[model samples]
Structures are given as structure tokens and as C-alpha cells.
Target: MPADPAVVDTDCCIVGGGPAGMMAGLLLARAGVRVVVLEKHGDFLRDFRGDTVHPSTMQAMADLGLLDDFLKLPHTEVRALSGQVGDEVVHLADFNGLKTAAPFIALMPQWDFLDFLADAARRYPTFDLRMNARAEGVIERDGRVAGVRAATPDGQMEVRARLVIAADGRRSLLRDAAGLPVEDLGAPIDVLWMRLSRRPADDPEAPLGRASAGRMFVTIPREGYYQCGYVAAKGGFEVIKAAGIEAFRRDVAQAAPMLADRVGELASFDDVHLLTVAVDRLTRWSKPGLLCIGDAAHAMSPVGGVGINLAVQDAVAAANILHDAFALDDAALDERALAVQRRRLPPTKAMQSLQVLIQNRLIGAALSGRPLKAPAVMKLFERFPRLRRIPARVLGLGFRLERVTSPDAFSG
Candidate 1:
């Protein structure tokens, strides 16, 4: 059947050119499916977002043959992840032994990561990259998704596809149009981020670690500089700004003294930006002929550094399932094709729930100086060698397909 006169047709039309959307497009396009990516921003790289790609994502990138390219970019390997419980710093390395080939976390700017994916997508003839295109609403027919209506500079245009993927971040226009329920797990604090010039003593190989004094602080290594972010109490940005730059510098210096020295060189407040961390989980991820990936489906809080890695995992899982369904001549345009959601939702929901429980219930109370200690829980984490392996395998990389299919299947 020919597409409507007012519509352009493709095998897959992906909304948003972020990591998940781009990855899905690349995977489908490689499988000889016609794919189009619609992005609202003219450029791919955006700032003030999650950037750490965990070991699992790195493993996925390696499978895609993009590992070397990623490593060539300015990045740091996080040898250890630490958490501050009261005045004590507990290293997480003991929780789970690093099982991934790339055991360390790669700290790179998200803009650079997206740019790399975009460049890779350009190599495939089956992929079409469309920028500055905003998806105003989805085109539905008989209670099923058919296509999307987008606003371009030229005017409104309709795009028809066998599959419509929503990867447009937390506040997705497509998800809203589909009437999906989004649950926001509010954060107790926000972050003020700044790019600090690298100190002569600073080592790109091993950047200074994250520290939390009732709030979190991290120094992520980026190209030629370091991305330093500080977690502030709710409504704390105004207080920091009102304290003046000098006072703010003093406070940062007191928290992470080494970072303070570097921050002192900052010329102005314009160098710093604020970001709010809110956890969002979608009630439904798919309907007939449509699916949502990445932040659109499940937006995890940054507490465990799982957001981007999980987004990449979602992309890989979607690609794998779609590749199989399309090959089997299954109706890729129906809810059955959304079976990937069945496979994805379980783990995504479980992890997101765990994050909320830990960050809000446990960590939140502890950060308030309440001296909330769960020694039994901590001892369990320390004693069980498998506890760390579970998270490392689950979050640091992709889900264990075989184990997820049958938990006891791995026993024999």
C-alpha cells in the first residue's frame, strides 16, 4: 500500500537523536530497514546531562566495533566508585568484582558521545538524519499508532513508518501524545555543575573521586578540562548565588579542596549551570506500532550512575528484538512487536525501584545527619560475593539474557 499523499514513508521513524534513538536507527538501518531520525536540536551535543558510560555500555560499543573510537576521545577511567556513609568512605569495589572487559567507567562528555553516534549513523545508506524537526503529535488510526506529525522550519509534515520509536528524553512529546503515565520520583537535592580548567597535577587517567557531604560532588574528566558538579540541598542554588562567587568558591574548597583550587580560576558564575535530578518511570512503554526507549521509558536517578548505561542497554535490546521480529516477517507494526517491552520493563522497573529505595529512603535519611546505619544490610553486601556481581552485570552492562529468561537456567 502506498503512503498517504501528505506523508513520507520509512521502515522506522525514530524521534529524538539521542543515544537510544541513534543506536536503534543504526541497528535497524544496518539490517537493511529504511530508518529516519527526527531531532529537535540542530546539533547533537548537549550539555548538563549524564555522561558516564558504564562497563556494560562499553561492552555493547565493543560489539558494535566503536570501542576504539570512544576510547580515543578525551575520557577518564574510574578505577573505583566510593560512597560516603556519615564520615566514613566505603568503596564499592568490594561489593562487586569487576567482571567486564572494560572494568572502569568512561567519563566523557555526552555531547561527544552523541556526536560519535551521529557520525556512525551517517555511514549507513538506510538511515536518514533529520534535524530541527519537532514531533508535535503522533498520527493514530483505529486506536493504533500509524505515524507522526512534526513541525519543521518549512511547515508541518507527516512521517509514516512501520515502527515509531520515542527516544525524546524524560518529557517526551510522543509519550504524552500516547497518553502514557509518567511517575516522577522527586529528588531531595539539585546539582550546580561547572567546567573547571585542569590543574597541572590533575591526572586524566585517574581523576579525583566523587565526594558527598550530605550532598554529592563529582569531577568528571572531559576534553582538556574537568566537569565538576556539586549536589546542593533543595532550593540551594539561590543561596549559593546570593553567597557570591567568592563565598561559593570557599564552600567548594572546603568540600573538595583540590577541586576548590581549580574552581578558583573560574572567571565568573556564567561558568556554572544548575540541573535538577528527577527520576521518571513510565507506566506503559509501548502501544501498537510504537515504542519508547531511554529516558522516555524509564528515567533513573543519577545516584548509581546507571542512566546513560541503561539507555544504551535499552537501545541494544530494542535493536536485537526488532531485528528478530522483522526477520521472522512478524507484524513489526503491532503490539506484538513491542514484546521487547516485556523483556525490558521487568529489569528496568526493578533497578529503578531499587535506586529510589536506596537514594531516597536510605541515603536521603542518612544525608540529613540522622546517623541511619543498616549494618546488617552492609554486612550482607560485604559477605555476599554474588551481590556485587548482580548489579555489575545488571546495571554496569546489559541484562543477562540467559539468566533473565530463566533464573535457574544458569545453575546447571
Candidate 2:
């Protein structure tokens, strides 16, 4: 027989401490609701997680009075976006025109962002963050979720709560355990991620990607290096590996000519990490006593790099909609928790719809060795500088930008 689980109680038990989980925990704890966030990893030092904090996110941080402190962290700001299309460099977006406090995308490592949020949230009396605690299954009572069973370094533990939220990335174990169905929107390409030292002279801020005939190369400027990606067609890594790592490096250099000099830094295949691209969404984002947000609700492609922003927005929305219930001391949180899904589902579907459209219409074509002819509509960005605001607004603000609307108990 298995050992008895140690039981702990909380108002809200959140699984998987990512963008959504951390943001929600902070906001709820601020509202004086007991929150327990479980992070499987002891530290948030993973590479190649969501790195772009969109202007919408920055604006939210500003609204929460954390902008100044947030900016103190080491980061790169992208005020404008540019890409090489068919041997020509074109300005894609101009964030300087956006109507927000911070009108640029802050490219900070996901680990740093998570760490900062966790530190800030720890200030709240109701915040309980347990690192190295991996949620194994959902605990249910009377056909409704009541808590979570998690595995830790020491032993199995049970956290009983009024509600459980799953923010555990795309492959959410909690979501699977909850039996929520997912819709696969499909992805045409996978990315091989690696790093190359950045030159002091390189353009520190560049657009999302540099794509050409059969290649899409993305290089993000970090503190001292370039985090690069080599995108390939679905299930295409075998062919790439067979051709050898040198050939792959040469192809990446060819796509993004600016990195030609440092291509040799990718000395072996071990240096490259393959990220299988997936675009999907859950059929239903909520259940009787459980809710799923962020990548657990929907997984986005790398097209706009807006997944993290959307996930954070989901957190804000969740806190806004459900905090009142907890604040009112409601033990039966079923209907209100479902309201979170009702409020956020539209925006989640809208973003995923747009991503699927772009993946099918643009990225898929690019990955298939087809040359992308710049549409005449794009000429407006070049001709009328003000027109750049269109895409900048979309990329920065997204389909729906959520703000912190819940009352903070600390303010009282």
C-alpha cells in the first residue's frame, strides 16, 4: 500500500508555476486569498522559454506599479521590428507609435521574469509557493475537483483547496487528468535552438525572424549572446541531422546573413535543441472545480511570440473574475470559476484563430521553399510611417489586453 499523503489546505491551489500561475498567484494573494503555487523545477533557469514580454504585459506591469522595478532587470527593448524579405530589409512594426506606457517588447529571459514575479508575490501574506513540487493528479470529492496530489522530493502530498488552476504549459498533466479535450490546429515546422556569442556591434533589437526560400532564422539578442533558431518542416530533423550539423549551420547563415561570421560556433549537434512546434487549444478551459489557463488552455506557435503575453492576460482575467468569489468566502466556486473561461475563451480562440491562419497562409508556405511576395498592403508601412501602428498595435496589445482589476487587500 502507498504511504498516506500529507494534506494542506488553501483557497486556491495552482499547479505548474509558469506565467499564468505566477501572475494569478500574485494577484490573488494580493486580494487576501490563500494561494499555493507548485513549481516542479527548483529554479526557473530553463532556456528558450517564452522570452518576449509584449507591450500589453509591460502596460499591465505599469498599472500594477512594477514597471520601474521590472525594467531594472537586464533586458532588450524592441521599439521597432524589421525583417529581411526576398533579399530586402523592410521595417515591419513601429512600436513607438503605440498608445501605452511602455511601447516596446521587453526581451527578458523567462526565468528572470518568473523569478521577479515570485519574489514580488512572496511579499503577500497569503502567498505559498512550493518549488520542486510536481502535481501528479487531481483530488476530487463529490464529482468536483477539491485539491491536488503532488509529488515532491520528500514524499507525496495533498493540497486541498476550493479550486485548482492548471498553468502547466502545453503538455499539462493536470489538464489531461481533468479529461479536457484538445484541438490540434497543426504546425508546419519545428525549431532547432542554439546560442552564438553576440558581437558588440550587432543590431541589438531586431524583428521576430529573418526568413527566405526554405529557411526561417530567428536570433534573439541576450545579454552577451544571440539565442538562435533554425526552423525546419514538420518531422524534418532526421534529414537535417543526416546532412550534418555544419550543413545546418550553413543553411542558418544563408537565411540570416548577419550571423554568417558566428555560424561556426555551432560546432556540434549537441549545441542545438529541437523544439517541436505545436499550435493547439483546449475544447473547454474550465471544469466543475478546476480551471486551465495559459498554454494549458492553448499552445501557440512561434509566429508572433505572443504566447506568454496571452497567458499573463489570462491570469489577470482570472484574478479579476474569480477574486470576488474568494473574497466573499464562497466555498462553492463552481459557477464563478466557470465564468473565468466564459470571459477569456473568446480572446483565447481569437488569438489561436489568427495564429492558425498565419501558420497556414504564411509560415507553412515559407517552410515549403516558397518565396513570400510582399503584399501591397505592407507598402503602407513603408510609405506612410503612421501605418506601422497597425501591426504594432496587434503584436503589442493582442486581441484582448487584460488589466489588474481586482482590489488589493494590501491597499487596505
Candidate 3:
């Protein structure tokens, strides 16, 4: 039988319907560019991922006019942040003097935030969302990306577009097809995530806390249940589970005595899930008509909790350049459009590198009970109240007063 004709053609074809892809499609579609988004998963949001939206990300949502909706969702307002240094809790409130509208971090499940973005994208007439379509490979013609080849249930098909975006995530098939280089900075620890029912009389103390020890526990407030995450060294899952449910409960109790009473409430091991934290940085973000955004470009370690926020920033930057690129009268398929990719790649790379350094080298050791300090770390909190603001900005909470061109521009 003859092959079916191209199902649909669009100006921009975005692979992956996660935050980065959806945000890019929303902006492009709103700008009147015909966009088609392909998502491998039927549903977008997955459980037990980064749920905290930094102050800067909230500001980004505000710019997109979704701030009110985002704020109205079931989330915990982290009035004060805290960290651990060998069983000692250091309140982050001291750094709250930094200049930002939402000085406090908001903890919401990542699934809800993604759902909101997808719903907003549906409002645009030019947006075409296709779920259960997995991108298998890229189609290249004359040393440039032509479009993509995706697999459907019945058969394989081709999608032709002027521009193709690989927001398919860290294990991006499109990135692999393009033969892009990926550097995986191994993670020193892994996280075991679980949800627990909050006691009716549980103390309502901001819904967020961390305990310092060989193991770390973070409790975040959800609508009805509390999202709890426990951190342990790599390859510790079997050891932890072998200790049995009672011993595991005791471990949590030792970490956060307040949550000890609630530990016994856990019904089964099925309630908990484990995730390995791996940091990755792409050697190149683009080639001709193809561009990689979000986790596809740079996957940061979960320590700073900046992955989603950085992905949002990349979407905005790409949209800005794409809008300009498509507006040109001679905007035919060529190397000229690659400029957008070039402009955004550097900052993403720099941020990812810094994340690896902080998560694996400095902060990782501290979180793991090692006693080593750099003078700069002490001065960051003591001498400069402004330095704390840098992270807020990096996480997409607010903008710096200076016209910063690079990530290093704000470093002290």
C-alpha cells in the first residue's frame, strides 16, 4: 500500500510537551506561528519531581499572564528556607533582605504547574498538540535539519517544518540523532520521594523543612497530602529498603523528629518512589534549523532546584529570537536562523556548569556532612546581602538592575 500523505505541516515542530516545549509552543503560537507539539506521554505531568517554583520563575509566569492562576493553585508558601550543616538548621531568612517581589519560595507539585501551561497553550488557535507520538529520528537534507520522523501506533510518519525544536528532555532521541555531544556529571546522591497524609493537628509551620545528616528529608505541603523527599548516597536504595519499613520509619524520625509521629502512618512501600539525580550539559544546542531547549540542552542537578525555571527562561529567550527570525522577509531555511540558537546556548551552558560545581563539589559535600568551607562561601552570606539575590534571579524570580549579558556578570 502507498504511504499516507503528511498528516500535518507547521512552521515550527516542537518535540516533547513538557514545560519547555509547551512554553515555546505557546509563545510561538500566540505570535501567529503555526506550531505542532508532539508528546510521547499521553499525560504531561509526572509525580515526584521538582515542585518548588523559585521567586524568579513566579515572575516569569507573571510575564506570561499566568501568575494569578499559578498562585491560586494548591501550594505551600515557604516563608523561610532552611538548610543543614551536620544536624544544625540554618534559617535562610537572613538572606531574605534580597530585592525581589516574591521573596519567599512557593512549593507546588510540578505536575500542576505543567498542566496549567498546557491548558494555556490550548487557548491559542495556532497551537496543535499531539500526544502519544514519539519522535524516533531527525530528517536532514543537505547538512541541515529538514524536520523529524516520529513513530505512531499504526506506523512511522514524517513531520516537515521550517524549524524543529528538541525539548524532548535529557534522553532526547532527537539530540542523539543529531549526534550532539552530551556530558553526564555523575550524581553523588539519589532521592527517594514519597507522599504522606498530614495529621489533622499537624503543626502548620510553613510546610517546608530540611534535616542535616547522612540522610536528608524535605517535607513540602500539597493540597491534602505532604510531599516528602529523602536523600541518600548513590546505591543506597537497596540498603534502605533492606532495613525494612520500621527501620526506614525510624530513619525518617531521626532526621526530622517532628515527622516521627506521621512516619507510622505510611501504609505501604508503593507510596514511595526513587529517582537518580544526574547532571548533564550539551556540547552544542543547535545545528542549522534544529534547536534543543530545557533538559535536552542542559540538565542540572536537583540540588538548587533550578531545572524547570531555567527551562522556562530558555523558552522565553528562544521565543524572542524566533519571533524576530520569522519576521524577516527573507526568513527562508538557512544558517541565518541559527543565530537565535547561538545567543541562548552560552547562558544555558554557563548556568549548567555552575550548577554542577555547586551541587557536586561545594554544596554536595556540605549536605553530606563533610566539613570544608571556602572563604567566598562565608562572605556570600555575611558580607553581601545582595549575593543571595543572585540565586533568586538565576532561578527566575526577579531581574537584576544591571544589564547582564552573561551568567558570570553577576558573580562577586
**Ten-residue stretch with the least lDDT total in model 2:** 326-335
lDDT per residue, candidate 1, 87-185, as tens digits?
554434422366555777877878888888888777778789889988888888877788889877777779987779999988888888888888776
Local distance difference test, each candidate: 0.71, 0.86, 0.70
For candidate 3, lDDT tens digit of each residue in 35-96? 89998887855888778777666666666657888799887776555454454434333326
- Superposition TM-score, candidate 1 onto the true structure: 0.84
TM-score each candidate. 0.84, 0.96, 0.83
Please, what are the lDDT tens digits per residue for candidate 2 over residues 1-412? 9889888999999998899999999999988899999999999999878799999888878888999999999998889887765666667799998889899999999999999999989999999999999999999999888899999988999999988999999999999999999999888788888898887575655645776777778778877788888878889988999999888888987887777888899888888888999999888888877999999999988878898998999999989888878645444477787777788888777877878887776667678788776556666678888888888898899878887888788985
Candidate 3: which pairs clash? 55-397, 56-396, 56-397, 57-396
Using TM-score as the measure, the top candidate is: 2
Collision count for each candidate, in order: 2, 0, 4
Q: Worst ten-residue run, lDDT, model 1? A: 402-411
Off-target runs (Cα >4 Å) in candidate 3 are: 1-6, 93-103, 153-155, 207-211, 327-342, 361-391, 394-412
